[model samples]
Target chain A: MTDVPSYLSPTGQEIVFLLLGVVAVGAALLVVTTRQLVHAALWLVVCLGALAGCYLVLTAEFVAWVQVLIYVGAVVVLLLFGIMLTRAPIGRAADLDSRNRPVAAVVATATAIVLVTVVIDGFRTAYAPLEPGGGSAREIGSSVFRTWVLPFEVLSVLLLAALVGAIVLSRTDIRGRR
Target chain B: MHVVYPAVVSALLFSIGVYGVLARRNTILVLMSVELMLNAVNLNLVVFDVWLRDRLHSGQVLTLFVIVIAAAEVGLGLAIILALYRNRATVDLDRLRALAEFPVPSPEDADDHLPENATEETAGQASRASAATGPTRPPGRDDTPEATP
Candidate 1:
């Protein structure tokens, strides 16, 4: 029912996914390596936004929007607040990284190799053609409310507990100071 | 087009996260790395869920749960880190050995790194301690941490 681009069918979508993937991975790398804490958080925003784009490409519109709203909006903001409250080295932390760079790089590379190999091999033959309502909000809502209601309620409780725990832990004077 | 496409990307993202957690000393950086890893898992879950075409969309639902758990983890983790920094002056994981029961053994006490008389003094103490304390390792002697005047 769409008339955007006949040639844009698979080739165009693949190119978009590839571009978003590149952005996501590069930003994720920055989030880890940047000495400045604020910059690292900003890079994480880029990475998370790009992943939301990937979800869009995968035809999971509901998930894509939720990713943007929750991850990019709420989570990153909370992290930034945490950084500011903790007096993070926003300018330059010369000692932000330790002497384990070489070891960690080796471990990360090996894990990447193993994960890529296994996932690619296992899903080589699998494919999912796009459908109009395959992953729309209506569909996701149905699944969530019917088959996954209990876990959803549990998650709400977990969030509430986290909120209270954070308040209790961060307060300097538990009883007196305002 | 292929399911492996997003899966591979997620793997690479997870690897970057692993490196961040291992190499970065700042507790905040470590927390951010964990978020990255969780995002990677979310990507894979949604991709597979769509690929399998499960009517329940279990993968996406689970991703939702993971997102909540990540939020909770960050909240607690940052609070702990803040409390730790307030108690101590630093957040360096290597430098913060507070959890260790006994003080870490430093070569500074042994003086083995010293130029001359290194072995003579340490060995003398070693023999003396073996004689006094039986076959087990001897307590610190001349250069003993508690021996300082």
Candidate 2:
């Protein structure tokens, strides 16, 4: 068989992935540690954008676009609106509740360790190379509409519920009427 | 491209998101951090899904679902924040300590105490402070003169 194209080779992909991964991580760190709320939100956008890049690198074009359309586009806009409406303190709070830092750190660390171990072990034990024709958007469309129909419908209902819950929580006259 | 590298990148993004959620205190910022984590997860799912490249296309479909949910989450989150702002002048999470079981403040009385000046002043102060403090200004607040210092 002829050799795979150099551009499509695993090595090339790895380099791209490495660069994007570093960007994603650095952005994420900024998102969490930054003192300013708006800054954190902006950093989150960077992190999410980097994630979209990762998906693109993986050749999951559909997922990458969805990530942008949903998380970056819709969710982040909502977050910014929340900040604006609530008038969250512009400056970092003098003391932003450091009481739970130790506990949160311990739990997060443990979770990370366990997750990393499981993922690594899984990769090592079940390393199945993907077929060349895999990851096409057309195939994904069919699968979502066909096999995953039930879950898809359920998800719609769940979204409806969330919408209703949001409305109820935001209603100004709930207690007033009673 | 090889899926491993993207997976690693996704992991790093996820870890940083975790750190943000843990460290940040502003509710809006915290929510933003959650979005970051979600994006990271979305990257991992898409990367692996692409690699699998089976007829199933499991990852792409799941990513769609995540997007939908994230949209709904933000809509609701913003509403809650608005209500909270009405009840309490500040959206600082520290000040919302008793949100769960606490009595909602009466709007009639609450509106009178709303921090019109406080927010304006803080915004102004943060801008001036950033210039005065150093070139490294914190993230969210606009450092403009209009904001009362």
TM-score of chain A of each: 0.87, 0.81
Give the Å shift of residue A67 in candidate 1: 1.3
iRMSD per model?
5.3, 5.5
Name the lDDT value of residue A1 in candidate 2.
14
- Candidate 2, residue B70: the lDDT equals 79
| Candidate 1 vs. true structure, TM-score | 0.80
lDDT of model number 2: 0.64
Question: Model 1, stretches more than 4 Å misplaced?
Answer: A1-10, A175-178, B100-149
| Clashing pairs in model 2, backbone N/Cα/C closer than 3 A | A32-B20, A38-B140, A39-B139, A39-B140, A134-B53, A135-B53, B124-B147, B127-B143
Fnat of all models, as shown: 0.71, 0.62
TM-score of each: 0.80, 0.72
Evaluate every candidate with DockQ and list the scores: 0.34, 0.29
Off by over 4 Å in 2: A1-10, A91-97, A125-133, A174-177, B1-4, B99-149
Candidate 2 residue A50 Cα shift, in angstroms, is 1.1
Give the per-residue lDDT of model 1 (tens digit) for A75-133: 89888987887776679777788688899999999999999999878876665565556
C-alpha lDDT values of all predictions: 0.78, 0.64
| lDDT tens readout by residue for model 2, A1-178 | 1322343344655677677778777877766666676776787778778777766666667667777777778777778777767665677655443456677667667766766666655553232343433445676677888989998999999889999988887776664331
For every candidate in turn, the CA RMSD to the true structure comes to 9.0, 11.2
